[model samples]
Target: MSIMDASGLPATTPDSNQYSAIPTTPSFPPPSRRVSYVASPSLTSLASQLPSNLGRSRQVHDLVRALGLLQDEEQEGQGGRDGDEGRASSPPRATILPPLKVGRKEIGRFHDLDYVDALLSPKTVVSPTNSPTSSPSSSSQSSSDDEEESDSSSSPKRKRFKPDPTPTSNLSRKLLSLQKFGLLDDSPPFPSLAPYVLALAGAALRAAQSVKDGTSDVALCWDGGRHHGRREAASGFCYINDAVLVILSLLQQRISIPNPPLSDPQEEDDRPEKTRKPRILYLDFDVHHGDGVANAFLSPLSLPHPTSSTTTSTSSKPLPGTPQVVTLSIHHHAVGFFPSSSLSSLTAIDTPHPHTLSLPLQVGASASSLKRVWEDCVEKVRESWKPDWVVVCCGVDGMAGDGKGVWNLGASEEEGELGWCVRKVVDWKGGIRGKVLLGGGGYNHPNAARAFANFTSIALGRPPLDPRTPIPEEGIADEDWESFAPSFDLEVPVGNMRDLNSSDYLDDVCQTFAVLAERIRTI
Candidate 1:
């Protein structure tokens, strides 16, 4: 039943073409490479999710191999080949983090605090001027664009005496404590938030390293559902908000690798200013209000940025030419409609000055709500916060009928471009400029395959022009994607998709029919 659009392909039709224009406030890296975070178990499920962890790590490794992210250690050892594949003798390892068991339910953790802050407060805008009049200053900078790559051909074998320097020493231990011990949120005397701060900072450093070299242009990662989590405790599924960690990491890394002022002051004035934290347009379109992400920023910064520290000013104080790093999550209006508590309650900290609302829908929350939310958040924030890079927490549960909060009191078959819509906006934007990385999120096991496929589509566009399947050449005019009446669901329950000779309807939208030479060249 899928129909092609003016672009000659399946199009995700939203309620309206409201926020389709390119966002000026938000921006991500130039269509850098699209990296997929895949693991054996594609989706982020399982109590321990151990086996899946290894698979996810493999996804990272595979991309690295394909894009050559890491140095080739054995090019010389095994002839002068590229050593891109089939060079490893041992099996890959799983990143199975010990299942976070709280009572009977398996939970998730948030290793980074900044990510937590950003989620909770998406609209804390910052101007992109270097060494601005107001803000926190830092030191001990790491090499931002300075890195040396080992030659693939005769990379020397060194002793195992090398130590992997962690930005924060206690990070891994605390990650263990934060994950396994579970006492992290409460200000336990000795334990440090430093670990998570550094873990995320290290991640940012690594990403920066990746960018400095020609290794990676775009990166996608799904992490830390921390809305329910608090400064002192794990709420919902999050243990240590990793998003905050990344943000904080970038901040710390920026400090460590000090931003030496441009030699030319006029040059700095003349050119587009770079952000301390990659001006990231962190967009989350899941049905749930990316509450965790929104909360992080909204929550008063532990050590407030200068902007956070200053007296709140008028929105019209002449916006900055460039944007500093920021997070913006538009959600279904929750003021009086739902959550009972006023939206202000969630905005206890520094919620975006004027939070956007997706509002409860009339026809019981059709797919349009999803598209609206995406468009609105991007558009509203466009003038204020265009990111240098974008990170999308791809949560598929909101496709149609969702359980964990979409503001829809009831459920409905969210047909048409359900997940397709989310994929389209990000993918299309990526096609033009900036990169969009897919990070798995909030899903149950049975639905994992579809989620993985969606991510696959995002990474590799439109299913790679299926060679086996031919496009309809007859050019029927005007039927949209859902027009074919893809009658059957993924669970069509046995029998063939359609009886070609019987003149019966084709129940299965994705059905693969077998035909002889007669069906072919019939055009």
Candidate 2:
């Protein structure tokens, strides 16, 4: 929980900014183009880094291919039309930024150098006891020899423990990093995970940078939303918190940054539209609390006070010109969840915090409860925050029937929830502006693909589909993709989940909101 400098550089040196700032601007496609994304032929090379049978790597590969193919089709169709015709036929989406490969410096912005090295260069050391070359002591051997003759007739031979061939490179031992954090029990099939992690981070940075420069109002990085990463440790299947890095990238564009190579004033002058630091509102809709992101924004004793000092301190301390980043997570708060130890627990609600709100729901939470939380708590915070930029962690695990989730939000209702949340945040930022969409924890891969596709369309400002309209032919061209593409029309009905919002739970939610609102007001 160290405080990252506004520029996202290490805060150790007194004047590190002089040596670290780089005036790197993202290259984005034309705004009129259909959704700009971040996949490349290099994706195959990156996927090759891991074993073919690895589940997480396979998921990443599938998503990249699916999105790339979808974008190509959309662009081909849009290319045939011009100006008004094209505008009328196609949906509105932000320009796609060119694919970027983040180097060590970029990774260092949000992570420690030692941690980054650990992730990229892990080595397994074997002790003498575990090594095969070391033999038993002479005294033990002598003692055993006397008894060996009597026992030899009845005793069985034991097999020697042979160590597996050691991997000489970092790519082969990448899973060891996860094991180090206690998130994994053993090494996974995939060892070359660094490329995918870097790719996700690059995609998110591309989106945020594009938004900052005004070429693209929103950027979608469907692969990046690992919000459980800590500065030194990993948790909740997250190694690097790409969402935090994205915010830092966006903030760098607006903050009074130093050491711009002493020659890139033209880049600075080009962005006259930005007079002040942009306000950011981060929303996480995953079934787990965005504890890593919340940790980044925490300040000591910034929580609410029992006495009237809360109001007095607010009036006494001068508010900064730029608002602190505001984060709100709407997720399951059930006991003994996968991330039960983190702030995802219900007990987190009682603690005072600043610039963040965790709205955790009980098990079997229905669409109605979710709607109420969004309207009463999420909306209020958004209104007060009045963000100039918004980053959303859209995790589809909250949908009904997800194996890893307990929420009962049915298919249609879950889709509705995502659409509603996106529309609200987009409208808050003004249509087609200042939104960065990221993917997070969605274990149900098929349903996740379906949900993201629907949400992608929503980001493009498209209207809701009619129940009578047939499903797109491309949507179900192959059996492999059928899970991603529903057979029925987009309007297929799904009943509300079983309601678990008892009166007491509802009261707790209301009280939590009241306390949160008071705390935010002070900020």
Summed backbone clashes in each candidate are: 70, 2
For candidate 1, the per-residue lDDT at 217 reads 38
For candidate 2, the per-residue lDDT at 124 reads 28
Q: Which predicted model would earn the best TM-score?
A: 2
Give the Å shift of residue 501 in candidate 1: 43
Q: What is candidate 1's lDDT per residue for 397-479, written digit by digit as tens?
A: 44322334342211111222334544444454422224433333334322222333334434433322121222122221233
* Candidate number achieving the greatest lDDT relative to the actual structure: 2
TM-score for all models, in order of appearance? 0.42, 0.70
Stretches of model 2 off by over 4 angstroms after superposition: 1-36, 41-86, 122-178, 181-183, 186-189, 255-276, 301-307, 310-323, 346-352, 411-416, 430-433, 466-479, 482-497
Put down candidate 2 lDDT per residue, 3-28, tens digits, no spaces.
23342222234211111111112332
Against the hidden true structure, what lDDT does model 1 obtain?
0.32
Q: lDDT, candidate 1, residue 306?
A: 25
